[model samples]
Target: MASLIEDYALLSDLRTGALVSESGSVDWLCFPRFDSDAAFTALLGDSEHGRWLLAPEGAVDDCEPQHPARRSERRRAARAAGEEDPLQGEAEPDPAAEGRPVVVQRTYVDSTFVLRTLWKTPDGQALVTDFMPVGDRRASIVRRVEGLAGSVRMHQEISFRFGDGAVVPWVRRHEDQKSGDTSIVAVAGPDAVVLHGDRLPQGHDHRHIGDFIVSAGEAVDFELCWFPSHRHVPARIDAGASLQETVSYWKNWSKDIPQQESYHAVVKRSLLVLRALTHEATGGIVAAPTTSLPEDFCGERNWDYRFCWLRDAALTLEAMMTHGYEKEALNWRDWLLRAVAGDPDDLQIMYGVGGERRLPERNLDHLPGYEGSLPVRAGNGAVDQYQGDVVGEVLVALEKLRNMGGVEDHFSWPLQKKLLGYVEEHIDDKDHGIWEMRGDQKHFTHSRVMMWAAFDRGVRAVREHQLDGDAARWEELRDRLREEIMEHGYSEKEGTFTQTYDDAEVDASLLVIAQVGFIEYDDPKMLGTVARLERDLMDDAGLLLRYRTSSGKDGLSGAEHPFLACSFWLVEQYARSGRIDDARKLMDQLVGYSNGLGLLAEEYDTVDGRMAGNFPQAFSHLTLIRAADAINGHGQRAI
Candidate 1:
């Protein structure tokens, strides 16, 4: 079985990512690109579906000790003596760790994406360093295991499940013509992977399996490269050099993250996570790297997030720009121009990496969903939905980039004008809203607010930047939208803005009333909305759910966990509202929810005390940076 959602740490090369668990198994990975079909799909299914496990030769629990329970015992014993628990004041233990597992320690090497996992057993100790080297033309993963102490026995298994575990590849051994090294290859119709390693595993039961022992000072390297089946396998890359280069690349990139002294460490890490999600070449940032990691486990709410949402990518760019990363913003802006280049009506909420538009949603019935979340989905159906807020998000992000000294060219400015035109065309159209509600479309208040922001930004562009556009018309639309929202979107009885026009229910998205400059953070209406959200959206643990799932506004079965991004938004709201104590306390708790390696999933299952939804979510991390910036008073007035 796959590890718990929280147990997996992410490794990305800007093109694609791999999820490595505490047990030393790469349970999830997509080849070539972030949206590609998975070759290691075990995270949503059983090991038989697919996984690459490299660990000490024993049952996973042999070296694991239940430390949380033990810590509870320690506290109890300390209380018996009328003393405080000694470890209470220390930094929290690694979440992935349980005292000492066979894989005792897992951590990123400084700010880099390269993950170093330490394994110690009765026999000896070993270390595995896993990384997907950056700047490669094709996707590649290099894992190196080195003996740290005395000799240690290690097991290796690789099973290729193409087409989301529905298609198994034909495996064969071949000799590299140039290097003369024996390599194992797996090929399906269009996808192929060549496995090159110093200690190659032999074939067994359709899988390449092996057992090897390494003594102190010895090391072994394994590299997996994905390519088209008909083409020749890519040449081998120098594993040692690639490791050093990857490390250097991240360290250099991290050096200029624009210091945030308060949450400096977390801000830097969140920036790194954002960078990991961004496609290095195309600049399309995926929402997350995995699909069908359920919001409600064992339910039908699961959906694919591997594609790039304009909303997510734009917001991510805004966060990056907040910390002085204009280059990334420029790259994504270029990607946006290429992606939504045609008629404004042709725009989509999301797109595949490289700006491919067709992302047909489908179910992978062969592989059970994460924790049995049924109908494992691939591709996002929301891509076709009309989200009025999307163009606004794009404009806001670009405006921030402009404020950060980015100069907009003819292409970008013209594109913004066209998007505004599109917004005008769809002014009265009911949208799926920011959450992409699958129910009947409504004039979502959040969507209306964003429409206001879109026109507002367009007006600012022409007035402030001397850009070419109809400033008077944009101002007219902006004022008209503000009036409409104040008139209909707000509820006099509820004393706050409703989810949609004439609706009574409140949404956590209401917390962003101030975030997008619709109102002051401390506006009486916003404060009232915050109070209503506190009453209805807050779980006992104080985290915020997106909306009341019980209300069936989303038209989906099964309830979801509290969205981490929503709570982070609350933190921002509190900080701006002068509730410093509340903001700080909530931020601390939310950051604590990140797993051992400081990676957060989409949501937190308070009842289960585990992560729910996709892993290392870009939305969650981007919001973390935004909230931290807000607390530090460094964020732009308009988020």
Candidate 2:
């Protein structure tokens, strides 16, 4: 059986990532690139379909101590009778540690990206697995294991089924003297995996089995590197040296993150997770590492989020830039320009990592979805939806770049002009909103407000930034948009803004009216909207839902849980409005939603008290950063 959604930790080479469970099973991984076909689909299907698990050879046991703190009881008896639990008396062991099972604690070797996981048996036997790259060479995944203490029996399960469990690889073993290491190579189509290390296990019916005993101080190592099947076998790699270098690289990268006042550790971890989701070479940030993890497990609401959405990328860049991560910000800016290069009319809402546009949605009927959700999807259907807010978000990002003193290249102005033109052409159209609802098109207020932002920023670029553009036309359009929204989107009876022009239902997205500078947070209208949201969208735990489902605006059968981003937006709204106390309280509770290791999923089931939807959502982390920035201010905030 698979672990809970929160049990997995993330590991990445910056180009792609894998989700490793507490018991040492890599259930989700996309090979070659972030948007590539799955090489391990077990997270969305059965383990036999695809997975690589390395752990102690035994059934998992849940051994919760009956008496958690006997010593604390004795100490409390010696002290006052009403004393609190000293452990709880302090902080709650960081909510990130809650529900995390005890395992050989694993992490990247200090400063390097190389991941090391250690496991020990109850009988004093130990196993160590180390994985790192060959120093920015070709696509490679290295694994090394050593036995220490008594004889440790280790289980190694490897499956290379590509295309969401459709293609299987042929396995073979070979010898290589150049690197003084034996190799086990698996070949299928254009993909090949080469394994190298000490005492390579012999193949038995397409499975490798081994057992080794080492003294207390002895060590053993193994490595695996993948390459194109047609390419010649690459030269031998130095696993130890590579591991050390990789650790150093990650430590240095992490050092660039800024320090902040409150929730520093959670913020840093969120930033680390955001960095892990980004493709290092291209700067394209994937929405999540896994696909088809249902919002409501066993339901039909599952959608793919592996591709990069322009809205998410722009907001992620804003969050990174706000926290003093200039290099990543600049890289993302370049990526944005390159991705939307060709023609304004051809601009897509989302794209592949390298900016490839054709992401056709398909179902993987062969493998059952996470928790039995059907028709596991790849690629996103929303790519074809007409989301007017995307261009607005891009314009906001470009303005932010200029505000931060990012040098404008020759292509920047032209790209902005093209995007502005697209927005202008479609500003009057009624299409899907930011939530990408599958219902009928309605005039979403947030989309119009962002359209106004587009025109407003474009006009500012010309008048304030001295850029060449039609300032008068942009100003006229900006005022026209604002007037239209004020007249039709606001509800006089409820004293709040509506989700769409034709409806009176409040949306949590209305909280962004202040953050986008659409209006002051303390403005009477904005405060009323916030209060209305609290009344209509608040879940039982005080988190804001994306919208009121009872209104039946979104055409879906089941209800969705509270969106983490929406709650963070509420936190930002509170902070901006000078309600610092409310903001701090909300921020603390929002940070508590993160699982052990400070990871967040797309949504939270307030009723069930668990994470829902895809794990480690980029939007959630990005919004967490934004909310933190709003609370702590620009420079003083932690990354």
Candidate 3:
């Protein structure tokens, strides 16, 4: 089995990413692009499903991993506040766990995607640096091993199962004509990768294994290159030079960030993560790298998130544009225009990295899911769903760009007009909300607010910016929407807004009403809604759930941990509402939830104190940046 989700850090070349575990296993990686078929699928199954392990012997294979859980700080805080304990029904700590020594330390080099891990054993210490070369399109992963102390024996094993672990590649060894060094090449169907190392491993049992030792002052290097099988093996490049270029690229891109006194460094890292998830060939950004990590462990909430979501991408751009990254905003604007170029009636919720449209979701029955969660899926079915908030997110994000002096070009303004026309046509329809609920469509309150926001921005473009649009008509609808929402979406008896117009349920998404200018943060109505959310959706773990699963709104079995994004939303609300101490306290806890390398997952399993769902989630990091800005007085909206 793979290590815990939080135990992994990311390495990216602005094309695709590789998930490297703390113990030096590249367990999950996709080739060529973010949405391509994976070459390392062990994150969803066993090692037989393609994985590359490079570490000291006995560090990964034979030893037992002990996870002895105790009460987390969130749980303790909830208990002290007299809230019901959320862990009562959870599983106890493992009985088979035993004490183990810690021998590995991991971190990324500052302002770069390079990962450095140090392995310490009884005999000696070895340092391994892993990264992907950027800007050159080499399509390779370079790993450098350096001996830091006395002699340390190291081991390397790689299994080449292509096509999502279904096809075993034909392996061959050849000597590089230039360097005269041995290299292993594997080909399956149209895909192939060449493994070049100081001492190439020999084949065994459809796998390759190599063993070597490094004494003080000795070093070894490895490079694995991926290319089309018909193409010649890519010529080797200097790994040391590539490292320098990659580092320089990331630092140059991130050097212009404005310093927010308290959370500057963390926000910079969060910004880098968002940038890494972006595809350079196309400006589309993915929600997360690996798919089907399971929102609910040992349950069926797993879904693929490799493709680019319009809402996620738009929100990511907003976070970037707020920090003066107008170039990224324009790039994403072009990508959006290309993706939804056809009739507005045919809009999709998401698209592939290169703007490919058809993403038919399917189950990979051949591979067992992570932690035995069933039906490891590929592609996202949410594309076909009618998500009303998506267009609004795009409009709001573009409005932020406009506020930053990004003038509307001929193409960009026309697209906004088309989007507003779509909103006008679908004004009376009921559709899925921001959560993309699998249940029946209802009058989701958040969706309506976003629709209102779309028109609000449209009206502002004409009235405020002298653009050519029907401001009078859009203003009428925008005003009417506020009245309709306040009338049907709020509860007079409880003085709070409901999740839908039909029911009195509270949703974490309602917290954003203040964010989009629908209401003030400290309005009595929003305050009442917050109280209801704090009473109902705030789990005993002290984090906020998206909404109540008991309402049967999601149409999924079991339950999920609190969403990290929702928790950050609460932090933003608190910060803006003058609860600075409360905001800072909650923000501190939420930031601390990240792994040692300052990366966050989609959700948090509070009972076991581990990260669940996708690793390095774009939602979690983007919301964290927003919340950090709110606390540091850098978050101000046109609303």
Candidate 1 ranges beyond 4 A from true positions:
59-101, 634-639
Using Cα atoms with residue i matched to residue i, what is each candidate's TM-score against the true structure?
0.93, 0.89, 0.94
Query: CA lDDT of each candidate?
Result: 0.87, 0.76, 0.87
Off by over 4 Å in 3: 62-104, 634-639
Please, what are the lDDT tens digits per residue for candidate 1 over residues 450-542? 999999999999989999999999999999999999999999898999999998998888877789899998889999999999998899999
lDDT at 63, model 2: 27
Estimate candidate 2's alpha-carbon lDDT, on a 0 to 1 scale.
0.76
Off by over 4 Å in 2: 59-118, 125-135, 146-151, 199-207, 634-639
Q: Report the lDDT of model 2 for residue 390.
A: 86
Error of 2 at 186 (Å): 1.3
lDDT of 2 by residue, 105-191 (tens): 666454344555666565455545545452385566666666566656565666656677777788877766665556778778887
Which numbered prediction scores highest in TM-score against the true structure?
Answer: 3
Root-mean-square deviation of every model = 5.4, 7.2, 4.2
lDDT of 3 at 523: 89
